[model samples]
Target: MSRLVDAHCHLDFSVFAADRAGVFERAREAGVESFLVPGTTRARWPDVVAMGAREDVAVCLGLHPCFMDAHDDLGDIAALSEWLDRHPEVVAIGECGLDARFADSWHAQWSLLEAQLRLARARRLPLVLHCVHANDVLARRLRQLAPPAGGLIHGFAGSPEQAMAFYRLGFVLGLGGATTYPRAQRLRRTVAALPDDGYVLETDSPDMPLAGHQGERNEPARVAEVCRIVAELREQTESRVAADSTATACRLFALD
Candidate 1:
């Protein structure tokens, strides 16, 4: 089988602190060779960057829209820019975007998201964006802001049309545990119809567990199952799906 890449997983999060090494070991054992871990807040950037020391780990730093409390009105964005400058090896700028769940902070989310978008644009880095209940709004924002280095829309469960909108904007969808569920018809259809370069496999570790593993902490190792289901959805061989998705991830994140 071709090696797989978990394009989005929070291995740096505290949930994996006790056995992070074991997590990586199992992932590699399961044929997952690389991971992209995105930082969700200023407080976590150090841990996120530190994970990059591992040969198989790549990092992206940005203040997530869900954690506005962890961000400052001025310093965080500037600090993120400086951090990226200091850590030139950092792969992208995000884990950032709008979330409707935090609607009260909607404007603030847009402010922070736009700031990160600008940073990614200025640096010519790809972004690992997160959007919830705002694809139309986000598509509009991307069109207007025009950040050129397309990124992944992590944990994408949007419609096929929505997926294509992001693809047209240079972004690819991160298909994760959600696709493993039989009831996720919309996402499955999106997966089936995705352009050759339109999507990548992800686990969103410790959060989006696969169908049979509900309530279990997800890990990078589970991405192999994601690949399996994706292959089934696309009516392609598992190795083909794994190879194509891994290649797309390498190209998107500039991984070696």
Candidate 2:
């Protein structure tokens, strides 16, 4: 069986509240051996940690840019940093980045994002970025900050040029359910063009459900289907996609 990894997901969200354990079970049955759950706010850290404590999961902690308005105090940043120092299960520092598509407050987004970037740098942890219509700005900041250990650009839907840019920064492109859509021509083209070692696969489960699975909540079990699509696009076997992407994830997050 192909051993795959969902490099980024939010299993801590309420969407999976009813059957979170069952979700992981199905994923294992589908040959998806591991997954990463990223925290979107300070309050979710405990739950994120709890989920990661499970046998085959890892956790990433940081404030997502889309939820910048949720944080009332900067002390949360300090708390996250302290938590990172204390937890070996904390694999990276993110779910953070600029999101110009959703909100108009560019300044506020940058402030929160840059602060998290600094925290990731300080802890020497990989970042799991969430850029939406802001790849240029994200690339610029990545160049400037140059975090010692780079991370994954989760849900990547940018141009091949943009993919090359992030790849140069030691960042891996995270291809997920979006690429499974028949109309995601540009994304498919980007995936086809990317080097085998340039990305890690993900499901972004309970959100970004695959094309045929639209309207149905996603789960990590569908990650293998994602690998199949990516492999077909790249003219490679599913096992090759799964193995390479899993290795990329392990190397990026320092997973054993």
- The best candidate by lDDT is 1
lDDT (Cα, 0-100) at 80 in candidate 2: 82
For model 2, the stretches where C-alpha displacement exceeds 4 angstroms are none
The deviation in Å at residue 226 for candidate 1 is 0.3
CA lDDT of each prediction against the hidden true structure: 0.93, 0.88
Per-residue lDDT value at 197 in model 1: 82
* lDDT at residue 5 of model 1 (Cα atoms): 98
Q: What is the TM-score of each candidate against the true structure?
A: 0.99, 0.97
lDDT by residue (tens digit), candidate 2, 89-179: 7988888888887667678878888888888888788899999999988899899989989999999999999999999999999999999
Please estimate how well model 1 matches the true structure, expressed as its whole-model Cα lDDT.
0.93
Superposition TM-score, candidate 2 onto the true structure: 0.97
